[model samples]
Target: MSENLNPAELQKTCLYDRHVALQAKMSPFAGFMMPIQYDSITVEHNAVRQKVGMFDVSHMGEVFVEGPEAEKFVNWIFTNEIRGFEPGKVLYGMMCYPDGGVVDDLLVYREFAPDHFLLVVNAANIDKDFAWIEEHAKGFDCTVRNESPVWGQIAVQGPESEKVLADVLGLPEAANLGFYTFYDTEYKGKRMIVSRTGYTGEDGFELYTSIDGTVELWDRLIAAGVQPCGLGCRDTLRFEAGLPLYGDELSAEISPVMAGLGMFCKFDKDFIGKEALLAQKGGEIARKLVGIEIEDKAIPRAGYPVELEDGTEVGIVTTGYHSISLDKSICFALVDKAYAALDTPLSIRIRKKVFPGKVVKKRFYQTNYKK
Candidate 1:
């Protein structure tokens, strides 16, 4: 606990003190001091998928938008339809540039109050997203504020997460919260927001509470036997679950259509990139993101060359990992759309040898997302 209290001018989260108290390995992440892990990455990753684990994800960005013009402004920026979201529900969507490239993937929280909502975004894209929103909000009457510093977020994930959280937090029906939904609850007389959402494809809840509450909640969850996980485990878990990391699979250069996220785009509603998307719709995507399973013992890695059966270069791997669940080397690659189909055979250039790989389903492991 005492190891991280020195004066380094690094930003700290509400759970920073608690992490230090638990003797976590702290490191810089997205400009904030964060815990990388309490134990080994592989151990924590397995814990979350098989048993129970919790992570301090307060480093994520939070922005609140509310006003009479809120709906209109949000509709203008995001690629999904919000007309169907009821209060206490959240929607997964993306904010994009006019050219149909993603600015950031976000979860929009529909508050109980009409015209009020919260946008949870990626930490690294905070400044850029804020600027983009503000620039596009010139004539709109809504106000946007970056609230990342005011709150701390925690994710309790795994198959056992529901039972453990309910037992520890004394919130019955907490486990019953519908997937992709949120609930405003009172815990220890303090207001808390718990959402059934997470980056790891496992069933989990992302809890938002005050800084003081965050410390207490963390302690309680730990006492309830929840394993403390870190960014490394978080990444591996999401990767194994076939989830995409922002910079790895999605970037300004990759459009949602090319990334197989076209379902999130609401063509019925006009968004910033609607014109570009429409223009490119039905046209062949030059390169597409797909998953590949390596056959040889050699592991495929990011930036490794991908080639066709004839040995012609196609693309490169963007994210790769040795899946503990599948017990095989798996990778995500942006390959020529012609080879994006399932079961397509390809090879990865590893060192001087070519390792055979096949384009399988993008999701390497089955997810436990609630119905």
Candidate 2:
């Protein structure tokens, strides 16, 4: 998808110059000229796993919904329940189409009031997600605003993330943040939103600040010896932790149930895709997402064919890699439900060779979330 973008038309984040100064390999991603790697993917990957790393995540989109019907409107559109959401709490879920296909997976944050909420969505689906929300809000007494451009985001992820933010950035309030929670604080007298949330399966925080504040924070972290990470390691880390990337694991044609994300879908509420998802849950689902451990060193990639011993095609790989942390070739594949069970024998076609593999737990490594 990124290959088709014209470099001249790509957007630049506030940290673009900093990335160039560090000699990061910049590429067009999600309509933006973003860094793919600064040093090596392995080194950056280990930095986050062992110590600390920071990411320029300003490309993510943020939308605000505020009104008397904010909770009701959010519940109607999203697959998760938000009945007990209070300020600072966040819920992860997907907005699905009527046919149960995913619209996008997002994090919904309950802000200062029950009538106000914030949504953090994928960068590539920002425009489309906002439009969908606006169109469905026809009869609700609410206000929907896309606030993507007004904020800049940086993710400080690792075991020492909190300490880095508190000591290096001098944001002492960061140490008090709880998992999946956020707090409004001040940095350099500028309002900032700090959340104990991250994409990597580690203890971390995501800070949202003004464009200028973002630049200052990035500089401060770099000066404090925090490694500047790029998207390459980000993918490997998230894959190792079994976190689903939107376009890879969940898509317009892939429902939450098929992606093994049924826990995030609440059936008691009447959501847009409730009927279809409930039916899928109660009936037979044709395919399901599962983990595959390749016996060989060959890496399996997205769109590779999955088959049984007799070469009968079953499904396709969604995301895969030679895991840096685990030192094994692993992949996430969407395959026939019959082959989704643990220990199921399977084969992945890589180039002209078919490599033997077995279905295992999707998570290659245990997450270290501070919950």
TM-score of each: 0.94, 0.98
Model 2, position 229, has a per-residue lDDT of 98
Residues 152-225 of candidate 1 have per-residue lDDT tens digits of 78899988888887788876677779899988987566778999999887998998977777778888898877
Looking at candidate 1, the ten consecutive residues that score lowest on lDDT are 1-10
Question: Number of clashes in every candidate structure?
Answer: 2, 0
TM-score of 2: 0.98
In model 2, what lDDT does residue 102 have? 93
Model 2, position 96, has a per-residue lDDT of 98
Which pairs, if any, clash in model 2? Answer: none
* Residue 111 lDDT in candidate 1: 93
Q: After superposition, how far is residue 230 of candidate 1 from its true place, in Å?
A: 0.8
| Model 2, global lDDT | 0.93
Q: Write the per-residue lDDT of candidate 2 for residues 9-36, one digit (tens) a residue.
A: 8888989999999999998888889999
Stretches of model 2 off by over 4 angstroms after superposition: none
RMSD (Å) of each candidate, 1 decimal: 3.4, 1.1
